[model samples]
Target: MSVPSGLPQDTPVAGGEQRVLRFSIAATAVVAALGIVFGLMSGSYAIVFDGIYSLADGATSLVALLVVNLIAGYNASGSQNRRLAEKFTMGFWHLEPMVLGATGLLLSGAAVYAFINAIGSFLTGGRPLQFGQAIVYAIATVLISLGMAWYGRRANRHLRSELVAMDIRGWLMSAAITAALLVAFIVGLAIQGTSLEWMSPYVDPAVLALVCLVIFPIPLGVVRRALEEILLVTPTALKQHVDAVAQAVVERHGFLSHRAYVAKVGRGRQIELYFIAPAGWPARTLEEWDALRDEIGEAIGDDSPDRWLTIAFTTDREWAE
Candidate 1:
């Protein structure tokens, strides 16, 4: 199967594995649009704040889509095609740092702006939300948030994409904020439905704090990933799986003198280990080595734009490294 733009659709992806990704993409766009509408209609500073958050989330979806495309690797037409494809698969690695810093700044600015605006409104005699309009908006916001969370969790299960999981968290928090507002609305609606309404304006800070809390992790994750990639640390999970594969080869082949080194390259795995066997296997020895290479490729080769190349070498026992 292939995605329309000539991209490889056969490979499995976190969100792109079938039509699940289409659900996520469509959901993101809908949520963002709804958020903007509610923000404008209710004058609920919290909702407006969430609207900005939603915009960022929309941008994140765009970035994720780009990443998915890169991993799919449908466009290659030159001598550097392979290299470019690999780099594209690894694009998320490079994009994270820059995206993190910018998102941090944007979120911080928005929080500060909202807080200032809210305080200014409060100083000028905090205005109360129009019950009918605000209640409808809150309900819509809450429903959207909840829907996003559900979709995000589903996407996480399907795609195993960390970014999609993060999106779920973002949506969950947005939903929670809206849920809180819904409660406040109910409480106000109960206390003469508008006679007691200080809580509505007060909750913005709490929600704003939540937004900051959410933004805090994005940069940290980016930094952690960057550090690992920079230090060339093989991801423990991938390394362990590779080791198991290599060790099995050794055990099965009865090779006594073999050294193994494995590293991760983008989504593809790399094996840089050497194995040595006795020179007496005759024609069978070469056959075994060739079989090993093929095995390594089949077992762990992603061959995606974001794949790692696992290289295995074999030599006579005396020549083993």
Candidate 2:
């Protein structure tokens, strides 16, 4: 048997997260537009690629914002929007991993494509660019990207949101890329009219290739995590804790045995515990059973809206098995 318990959802944190994402989206749009325009004016493929990456990042952030809203609205206690809850009975936790996976794959693919293009350009004797225009654009973009990355990290300290964290990483990556571009542009500018001036044309493609190599592997961690959640892989730590709790409960209550099942999907933790009572144990009232369940829940800890916990007691081992 199971007793439904009420838990307060952190709506304020969710709202704060949404606000940060909206700000990021707006900033990304402006930066992307600037990148494209400056890239065309300066004839820098690296700048154009930066703009394209920002555009794709903005799209993923938009999707992340939607998922956050759905999760917050549906999970809120006493929410009147039963339509979503009714339709998505398992909750919106699954969407989190899907979004993460998509973001990682999209960003990784972009990096790979950029790397290939950089190689092709390098092989074609590289292309000369207006270092003055490119440097100006890179400096401005570096400042903006750094500011956004700092803001995201600061906000995520309290929020601890995966979407926001991913966004923070994106911003940092952007900042690093722009900073490298600024340095490359400066070197290219300094070498003009000198013996090293011949190397200016190769700087952009070489730096772009190096940046792509650095970025391509960064998102693989997120992808691996998302795949684990999507597969409903039982988290080892969570499973161990649940098993310990169940074993303690069985020993304390003198139960024949216990079965525990645990899995983590996104921010949600699903746990099921079954205590196998003796064959001829005395029957307890419904209230007593509920109290036992509460005890077990408290022992397991982490009482949150994201936790889906169910405890049952039965004499038949077949039921638990």
Candidate 3:
């Protein structure tokens, strides 16, 4: 495994990332509760959707936290725990992409459903809302969401965690949604005592529809990335880097040829390199070969638990192939 410079290799010491995620969970939970409460009080379906959205995000965050804990436990104790080794022979990297994909799908489904409801409401001439209460809720949620977003972004600069990146983006999305709601509610209130009073009833459904249109496709990118990991698709840039290193090793050592295979699964990069030694090459001690392997490892770089690197020297070209 080749870990990146200054990055923890998904070990227990990476607990700071978990703490950030927990903070996000707590913040999202509070916002969800507030959304549901103020949504009902204000009779705004848009606000209700916002609440449900936060609630769904919170649930997914809990799942993410659990996965993080499990992965940390595996990395910290797998060497000593026979059960864990047996249960996760390939490590827990696969779980990350799976959880991410499921969360994304769940979010997109909810948004689609909300979009349909919003459309139905619009068709029925929309619903009335207490713009004042809605505005208050939106302002509070916007502040909370922005705070969490900032915190997550700052924490991730050191952690460089995919989970944290997703968390930060979720918070930013929530903040944007709430900010939009605040503007709409304010506009609704502005028109309450004017010639546009008849337009008041349409505010809730109109905002809901707009929010849906904006957020419905937001999770698709997450799901796409997850699918790539799940499929063990080769990352182009990583493959190119690995290939270049393998080629260098082959030319430097006078090996007959070489082959390399690379794939990225979640946070893990799996690299396998095989070098075919010429049949008449001078023999070397096992220790010398090990030293060479270490040198090659250093050259490849990015050593980490999440990096699964296998390098082998073979006398037969068939083995390398």
Candidate 4:
């Protein structure tokens, strides 16, 4: 896959992901405020939980935005200040996974707390709510959640950002939970004049419990992925791709053997290729060797600032080993 400018498709651009996060921050702020106020007024724990969820998400989004700004300012090729360069000697790639992991952990913690509260409410014969007011809040929130979810997904088509992707998933989950709450509130309202009125008290806590249960597992994937990056695990697909390119270069250059090491951390790819030349092979000039390295780099196909490629040639097998 390739971008419009014939660049590789996975290349991260400057504005798109940040723009999406900014929009999410604004939308989440509005929702969080509304949820807190209406939840307090209507005495619905589910709405309050939703509000807190959005608040936590907003905080994480802010952190992510800060990291994004730092990364954008530290250009690999452009002029940079000595202090900033020294501070980020290893690049800001490590921060990406760290932020992602923190976001996931925070979300999971909130969900667990909410779940416990829901269980307490259920065991205590449930909590009564102003169904009419709750329904109104749910409808408005559902609409906003759906709108933001759609917007995030559309932006990700171009941005292809992991942060944006996670944000989109959050929006979708919010939409589904709020939509379910809307239906349950409607049912509770209808039962006010019937024999099933007793069941009305259980509706709020029941819905909240189910919502927490469903959303609890969702962030586990994000945590797992973040851990992999933090551990510097080599991605299987990327390793295979690098190995293929190294093999081709070795065969073409008539080298005795080659060794390749690759690892991915967030958006950064680290690759090292070492080739052992045959004993008594014809000597090549430094320029020629550099040209060969360039050729191999081009063949590897990911030419971006975040890519760290190192190629070495030596007649000593120990070096390649």
Runs with alpha carbons beyond 4 Å of true place in candidate 1: 1-26, 75-127, 152-158, 188-201, 210-231, 248-268, 276-286, 295-307, 314-321
Give the worst 10-residue stretch by lDDT in candidate 1: 1-10
- Candidate 4 weakest ten by summed lDDT: 1-10
Query: Candidate 2: misplaced stretches above 4 Å?
Result: 2-10, 76-80
CA lDDT scores, all candidates in order: 0.57, 0.89, 0.85, 0.85
Model 2, range 71-188, lDDT digits (tens) per residue? 8877565656567577777788889999999999999999999999999999999999999999999988988998999999999998888899999999999999999999999999
TM-score of each: 0.67, 0.95, 0.94, 0.92
How well does candidate 1 score on lDDT at residue 215?
Answer: 51
Query: What would the TM-score be for candidate 4 when compared with the true structure?
Result: 0.92
**Using lDDT as the measure, which candidate wins?**
2
**Candidate 2 clash pair list:** none
Tens-digit per-residue lDDT, 187-267, candidate 4: 999999899999999999999999899889888899999999999988999989989999988888798788888887777
* Model 1 clashing-pair count: 8
Question: Which model is ahead, 1 or 3, in terms of TM-score?
Answer: 3
Measured by TM-score, the strongest candidate is 2
> Judged by TM-score relative to the true structure, which candidate is superior, 3 or 4?
3
Sliding window of 10 residues with minimal summed lDDT for model 3: 1-10
RMSD (Å) per prediction: 6.1, 1.8, 2.6, 4.0
